[model samples]
Target: MGAHQITIVDMDIVETSNLHRQALYTEDDALNMVPKVHAIKEHIARINHHVDVQTYYQEITSNNIEDILDEVKPDIVIDGMDHFKIRYLINEVCHKHQIPWVYGAAVGNKGTVYGIDFKGPCLKCLLKQMPSSGESCAINGVLPTIITQVASYEVAEVLRYLSGEGFSKKLITIDTWHIDFKAMNVDILKNHACEICANQHYSLLETKHQQHIESLCGRTYLFRYQSSIFEHAHHLPGEIVKSTSFAKLIKDDDYEITLFKDGRMNVYGIEDDEEAFKLYHSYLKALK
Candidate 1:
């Protein structure tokens, strides 16, 4: 298969914290303001320039979803997003479109990888019995080894499916801390009368989840908005404040926001690169 035929949809950025477990990143890689998808694409290109990679620097919310999936037209989608909202979005979009996708999650020293081929149970099918999302790395703090291990398994599954190696329709969980791995059959449960699966309902993807914000002393980068336009405002350089505790508001030539200790802030300046760049640095000072 040609490299250009595969496109990974990841909208996150490389953070200083992710270096501890992410194997393919360097200090300079994290320093660059590139989105995680682009960063991974660039890294892959170094190994094989023939691979066609793409990215969307915006969060997967109710808005801008069609544009993302439409632009990618990927043969299969991979899970690189941390946001549960986005994960569910991918699940529903894939199920609705009948485009199979893989599910994976890692945190601390454990993770899981599974595939959702058309004949197998989907993420929503599993969620009918389990919780909405698996344990997130943000809350548990992922180990570099754990992410690498889980990601490698995920990639292996991808290769298997694409190379006609054929993947098992089972859920695979790995616990690196204990060095345990297990896979169980789940194909039959897909049609076992589940709300999200049997009934073909996808409440998680259909709903809109809000993000919270917090203010810190000596800095300001929080903004409040009740408009849908603000959803796509990601490309415009702005912090999304989900909390209402921040009472103080500030603005400058091209940025406006408030800051809190919880590390949440908003930016509203000139909706362009120059202003976004300046505000990002200014916010970084507060982040420090």
Candidate 2:
């Protein structure tokens, strides 16, 4: 609703490992940065002086979500995150409050961007299930050009919508490998049974799903242990592998731990959820 001031709520950070696909970052860019929100805010300020920006270096968990939304009170929200969990939360928040937000994703040479208006179908309408467990840019590999292209398209749509220009409620897909682009018009395919929008259910904002830390999409996770556990983490016997400056990947025989500064973990090569929990506890004990 406002002119140019937009608040960006992101919990991740700039990392050396992400430089390839993170076109906006350099090793020194995140040398001492603790959160992604801060890094992105600074980057935007440096490049686009016409935009008003604020950064929240905290996760959009159930507990602090309402408070952050209220604090930022953004006229428009943007999806700078790779994870879908928080996007779900944003959808619910925007729809309930009548705010609009944009969604974007890039992997390898491909990506997609879409805008969610308050009056139509939301993210849930595009898919029939939850995100499957798998690899990410950290697990797989992404090029800088693709990520930049995706974010550029996302911002383009944001600018258009914010400036009284409306975008198609359809899905926009692009494949940079072949330079192919297509916009699928689906404005009439909105679902009346969407659990988040149509149901008026704000379950994600209720505080139950919020974990101490969370792994976003892209085979990345954060291991946020209690402050008391910091010193103990040194006792663990293996090198903690990390993405440039974005995420830490710690692995051993039975498992791999992808941890972020936000205190979340993405456990891979393990089938059992209980085992994931056990691994989490094992790492927690070491950190303690």
Cα lDDT computed for each candidate against the true fold:
0.60, 0.68
* The best candidate in terms of lDDT: 2
Residues 165-277 of candidate 1 have per-residue lDDT tens digits of 66667788899888899988886657566554457676755666544321211122233233332223333334443322322234444555533222334443334445545
TM-score of 1: 0.68
Mind giving the per-residue lDDT tens digits that candidate 2 earns over 1-288?
A: 334676767656565666666655667765643466667667877988788777676666767777887887776777876667767877878888888888897777788899888887788887646575333555566666777788878878887886887766668888888889998886766888888778887777665644643444443344456544333334654666544344555677766655554555555565554555666677776665
Model 2 TM-score? 0.79
The Cα error of candidate 1 at residue 59, in Å, is 1.2
lDDT of 2 at 16: 65
Alpha-carbon error at 269 in model 2, in Å? 8.6
Model 1 per-residue lDDT at 20: 75
